[model samples]
Target chain A: MSDTKPLVDVRDLKEYFPIHTGWGRTLPLKAVDGVSFTIKPGETLGLVGESGCGKTTVGRTLLHLYKPTGGEFYFDGELVTEKNMPSLRKQMQMVFQDPYSSLNPRMTVEDIIGEPLDVHHLYSGRAERREKILSLMETVGLNAEHATRYAHEFSGGQRQRIGIARALAVNPRFIVCDEPVSALDVSIQAQVVNMFEDLREKLGVAYLFIAHDLLIVHHISDRIAVMYLGRIVEIADANELNNNPIHPYSISLLSAVPIPDPRIARSKQRIIPEGEIPSPLHKPSGCAFRTRCPYATERCAAECPELTERSDGHLVACFNK
Target chain B: MSDTTPKKAPFSMQIDPALFEPATAEEKKQQEVMSESTTFLKDSMKKLMRNPLAVFSIVVLAFILIVIIVAPLVVPYGYSEILKYNGMKDKTAMNLAPFQYSANEQKYMAENGVTLFPHIFGTDELSRDYFIRVVYGTRVSLAVGFFASLIVLVIGVLYGSISGYCGGRVDLIMMRIVDVIYSLPDMLVIILLSVVLKELLDGSKGIIARLGTNMVSIFIVFGMLYWVGMARLVRGQILSVKENEYVLAAKSIGTSSPRIIRRHILPNCLSVIIITTALQIPSAIFTESFLSFIGLGVAAPMPSLGSLANAARQGMQSYPYKLMFPALMICLIVLALNLLGDGLRDALDPKLRK
Candidate 1:
């Protein structure tokens, strides 16, 4: 990563959803808790975690789609306050996971993609707007003629492409691509991912790519951040993190990724983490991962490990590491 | 991977396939919606055409409405006009079988095998034309159906949407009120109100005596009674739709509640509302007619199907024509409306599409 000003610098961002108990009473469930990351210019930062590990929540919170319970965010060397959200939104966009949904079924593809343009008042006239929409569709590998259609008729891959087109419509410099290919077929996944990469290369855009598939993330991400129960356990350069995972959870996760070469796969012994992930509502006293960590000692249970850099780029949060 | 790529095309030189390929799923869905809308309307008309019974009833009802509207123009005689009669010992002329007069009569001349002139549906015991009364009766039945349903439409949509969207405590409270109202005897309330109004008007003097308690006020009573069922139906639909994923997506996007309800929720529920409204009109029309038949409806001499039937009920043996005309009109109007409602239901249901 370059030692320059990052496009998005999120510091200890948190979002807690409340669970109502009986009449008018509630308790907080910490969906995202004290997680921080930064995306350098023209870099893809992949947030890899299993379902409900708060990866999606992180992406949403960073965009201010959901109100963060805590933390500060800096966009382009400027602090992102509530007052500047509208203007800041023009620079940031998101692509959701579900190809079947996300795009409004009721709205035509043209309207869906042109919505951001409308919100930011980008185009000069109707003709100009249509021209821009067609261009965006071309960029995302969608037919310009398909603009008049609704979303439900498209295949999963095509719908994701439309969603990608919508995200790119405002000419945003950064996009939060939340599991862009997870819902697609095995054959179509690579196509959509390649299209995304081509768009990034052509437009020089940054992305906070959220996905559960570590292999896909490793392939696309310049750097990777591993999350567990709403906390970032480890973050480092993609190859370094994959080759030499320090944290137990990260090591187990990397070990579980199937090697394409049969010899290496047969030689490797996978390290499965102990037990199920504890509920976020009643997290462990110290490290949230302690309950499932095989290397958990007295110190690991007594205090939470801070995310500290051990080398030039490798950051890990583990007492044993 | 190499096999998938074109041999001549280098990186950044491949042809775009999205432009040449068949239309995407989204376009096809839109086409289906457009076609289905056309098909829905076409199918409704086709179905209506196929049901001969429904078609016949509609024709009869339309004819009745036309006759009622044109009664003032066609029937020149006033309602209370007294027919001058020369002294005759036989009072049997008062209850004569419509077109028949005894051949024994000398002074009274016969015209077209009948002495009486222009009583197409014969006359009542009082010698007033039953045909004219039945013709004018259309105005009252139609007016009640139209105005009462209008009120129901407005009230039901607003109440149901608010209750459904707000949910939780607000929904519970509104629903309880509906329950309380529903549990009451609706027809009894209407009957009692009509009776009280009738008595109150009877004692009043001056201008009231001149216009003499206009029958149009009966619509207001019926309109109030019909809204509860509509409100309940709308509320149930809204409750189901409000929980749908699309609704959740709207909320997540930070779209305001009112706009979501108006633009999204309302359009989705439109089909249901239309079907319900069509069905409601017939029931409301029937209710008004029933009330009149029991003397709690439009006051005497107003010429509602109900009034004509009621008058005929008392003199059925003496004047069978009085009962037959109004009864046929009532059955015809109700049956036609019901067929239209059934046709509307099938047309509006999206799942019914081929």
Candidate 2:
């Protein structure tokens, strides 16, 4: 990872959706606020957060899927703005969640995968295009016969593979896998995760793999970034973060994962956080997680914590940490 | 032989021997692969084909259309020709019928056999055969309905699709115009416009004279007036479909707006448009009939269903046979068309099958 340059650099990115309160007034819903990350060539950065923590919004904003309300995004060390978005999009692609709904049902699988090729003009002729599509399908473990079928005919895993093929058709250097296997069955999820690993090995592509499954993220990611309420609570090397999660949110999330070993599981205590995630429309004053944090102090409410690196490479964002 | 011998490779490098061997316990418990051939369209078509009532209605409508198309050739006498039975005493056949030989007619002409030969549906007060007039009139009713409805469809699709696709201020302005037009009674507009057009084209001797100077012009006037509602329906469908994820995907991929509309949005709205077209055919036919009945339709000598019905209504009290035949045909035709339309509505309803 150190030998290659960073493909994407995101700093303090924020996206706030307006919540209309009738009579022409609207309040801002801070979906992604002050989120920072970077992806090196041939590296996968896992973004794990509970529902509504704005992890998906971060992926979208990095690719400029939604125009950012605030912050800077640099692609290949150059600042990515709306003006050069089309060209930047050619380099950066996204694989959306819900593989079933992401691909157009009306379009054939070939057309779906061929769309990017058509847009980019990568092929010399129709035969070359067909050969490329077949090779791509083979790379993703799909048959040549499946090219003419519609998206609805494929299984959830196959659909995600088709989506991966579409993203790869542009020969993009970077990809944001936004919960690619979240909608698939548990058995299918492993196949998709393995496929992602294979793609990284074969193409040397970088990915910001967004998923709530810590186990899967740990298996595939070099580093993990844990988020809570639009802010990343912790980020560190995968093994280091799993061993010593200093943030209260990260600690609770790690504690919830059931161990496969009965002896280890019997000794470990589960730290289940109480209550639900707060609405972004009316976020708490200081630390957004203060409402559900077990270690909340009077100071935690008065001041927001800044992320600081510990002795190892693990970064924690809490006053006590 | 020794030099050409193949060396045995390591188990890891060779293709997995487990696949050629027996399956593992773990592999055996995996979910079975379900076939993925069934699609939305096939499922819908299957459901539609199973519906006996819809099939029956379609058959009836086809039969009616066939009758309408061939009515002229099948009928023996011309519409305006007087069919006199007693050779020259045309008065005897003023209000005649079949299966009933006129005694006075029998005494005048013993050569000509029966009164029924000349008048299949019998004659009216003018002694013109009712059957021949009704048959010829089918042509006028059908032509007006078909041509006018087509005009409405084209106008409606264009207006609605544009307004729906480019939504916001443009949509607001277009819809406001639609609302204003919709507020007025459709029938009144048809009547007023036809009357004015008829008056304007009267006494003009050119191409207008060749085609019923007033009739062709009135049909055009009515067709233009009927497309507003259809446009509104199409616009409503387009508004909903445009926000779907596939549309967003197309936009993200840098597909042009027109291509997105033509390929994605328009195809999604086809079911609604087709079902509406079927239903509107009867409406167009009814509108033409009403216009002719009120004496604002086709001019004298050229028979239409409405004009025939009008003539029938005049002599209904005395020569009742004149009114009954045309009225019956109108009811049967409209009823059959409406049933066919209902069947099509079910066939095209996506939610009904899937």
Candidate 3:
């Protein structure tokens, strides 16, 4: 990692959604609980987890899109409070997960991408605004001719690029990319991922790349953070975490990834966890993963294991690890 | 040779099939939305042009409007003018058939060596030109329909946007008010109000007197009752459309609520608004005709279509054609508006787009 101060430093963010059953009674759905991470000026942090593990919520919270139910977000060493959200939005933007639904159908490509510029007043005149919008589109590899087109006229990959261009319009330092390429065809995924990498290098923007696909995350992330039911199970350097995942949950997750070599792939064991994930409403008393953990013991049930550093800059949440 | 010289590159390098080359300039014209800028409305308008029934309806409505507006200016007789010359009633002209002239007119024309003009649709029992009366009746019905629908549109859009976008307590309170209004006996109230308003506006001055008491009362009833349907539709549309991801995206971009509601939410709900408003015109026209049938519409001599039909009913056995002209005009207008409404719904719907 670089020695420079982190561009985005988030500590112990908690987002609890209230579910109203009836008549003044409500239940708390802990979407993100005590999550902590930091991204340097140009670093990419990959967030990987299963569906409904609150991966998207983390990205949303960092950008202050959702009013963080509880957390401290420091963007470039300044605290991100509600009062500053309007101004801070210029420095931080987001690329949504579903490219199909994200862009407004009624708006033209020029207007979609120009909205950020319109919001920030980045340019002096109409010509300058058009120039900036066209340049942003070019950065995302879109043709200038695509400006007048509507969202439905474009393919899924092209639509994603329009979204990326919109995000880049504000010239943000960090962007929270929530599965920006997941909605594309598998063949088109690689092309989009390559463009993302190219744009990252060209623009020097950091990202919290959230996705459920481990392989896609592994390709572009500088560091990897594994989340299980809204809590970080393990976090480490990209190569270190892949080669040596400390948490039992991480080990099981990493093992699920298919190996190309036939001999080695045959030798690997598939550790599929038994039973469905326990509901967040009725989570296990201590050690939320213990319900499906093969090595569950009375000790795990007695105490909730906090994330502890096992080695230099490598953190794991299991007591055994 | 391999050691001494540089190795030749693969043949595929010069003709890379897998390279990320964009399409050539020649093929750019084939791209969708490439020719010129077009909005959802403009695109929908183009689609509307393609629908034969809708186009026919538009032409029909335009023709009716032009005739109603222009016919009175060129036609010599007033709709209510009792046939007379100088201070004497031309009694012989009463109940004359189309193309038939009075004896005096024919004799005067023979003396002057010129053709005497005939009443195109003949004369009524009161010896007034039937064609001009029918035209004036159409004008009255069209005006009432348009004004009523305009009132509904203005009130409904404002009320619905506030109710749906504000949400929570405000929405609940506003919606309950709508429910209360919806459940009320609307027609009865309209009838009562019409009676009361006519009494109040009777023989009034300026625009009120010009519109006549019944027309003014019809407008009031429209303002009170017709807006609820439009409001509910707009509210429902705003509720769903405001929840879309694009709305959230707009919010995340730091857009204010009012601007978002105007630029994003309202434009998205435009299809629903337009369809409802178009349908409202026929509905208001029907309501006016119904009220007029019961002797509650525009006062006599103003000659609304319903009044004309009512006037013709007394002598239906003698002059059946008198009732047919106004009745046919109403039928044609209502059918045209209904087709146009259906066409607007199909054209403007975002989901139906390719």
> What is the TM-score of each predicted model, taking all chains together?
0.76, 0.81, 0.90
lDDT of each: 0.76, 0.80, 0.86
Better candidate by TM-score, 2 or 3: 3
lDDT of 2 by residue, B1-354 (tens): 244445535552434433576778777766444344445467556766677876776676677678766766766667877655536646666767743435555654475554434456776667676667777677677677677777888999899999999997899999999999889888888888888888888888977787786567766775677788889999999999887756755555555678778877887787778777766766776777787778777877778887788877877787676777777777766676666666665765543443
**Can you write out model 3's per-residue Cα lDDT over B1-354, one digit (the tens) per residue?**
336444545552243334456888767756544456567678888989989999999999999999999999989899889887546777877877877887767766788899755798888888888889999999999999999999999999999999999898999999999999999998898889899988898878999887676788898899889888888999999999987777777777777788789878998898788878888888898888888888888876778887888888988998888888898999999899888988988887655665
> Which regions of candidate 3 deviate over 4 angstroms?
A1-3, A22-24, A261-263, B1-45, B85-116, B199-213, B345-354
Query: Lowest summed lDDT over 10 consecutive residues: which window, candidate 1 chain A?
Result: A99-108
lDDT per residue (tens digit) for residues B1-354 in model 1: 346644544444456554575889998998645332233345556666666765775677677677777776877544534333464333443444555543433235543354445556655677555566666676677777777788889988888888888887999999899888788898898888777767767766776565445354465565566677888888888887775544544443334578778856776687678777867777777787788777777667676766777777888877677788778876777777776666555554434444
The alpha-carbon deviation from the true structure for residue A92 of candidate 3, after best TM-score superposition, in angstroms, is 1.4
- Model 2, runs deviating above 4 Å: A62-65, A78-83, A118-131, A261-263, A297-303, A311-314, B1-66, B73-125, B168-170, B196-226, B300-303, B310-354
Candidate 2, clashing residue pairs?
Answer: none
Stretches > 4 Å off in candidate 1: A23-25, A63-65, A77-87, A118-126, A259-264, B1-109, B112-138, B166-256, B286-300, B303-354
DockQ of 2: 0.23
DockQ of each: 0.19, 0.23, 0.50
Error of 1 at A278 (Å): 2.5
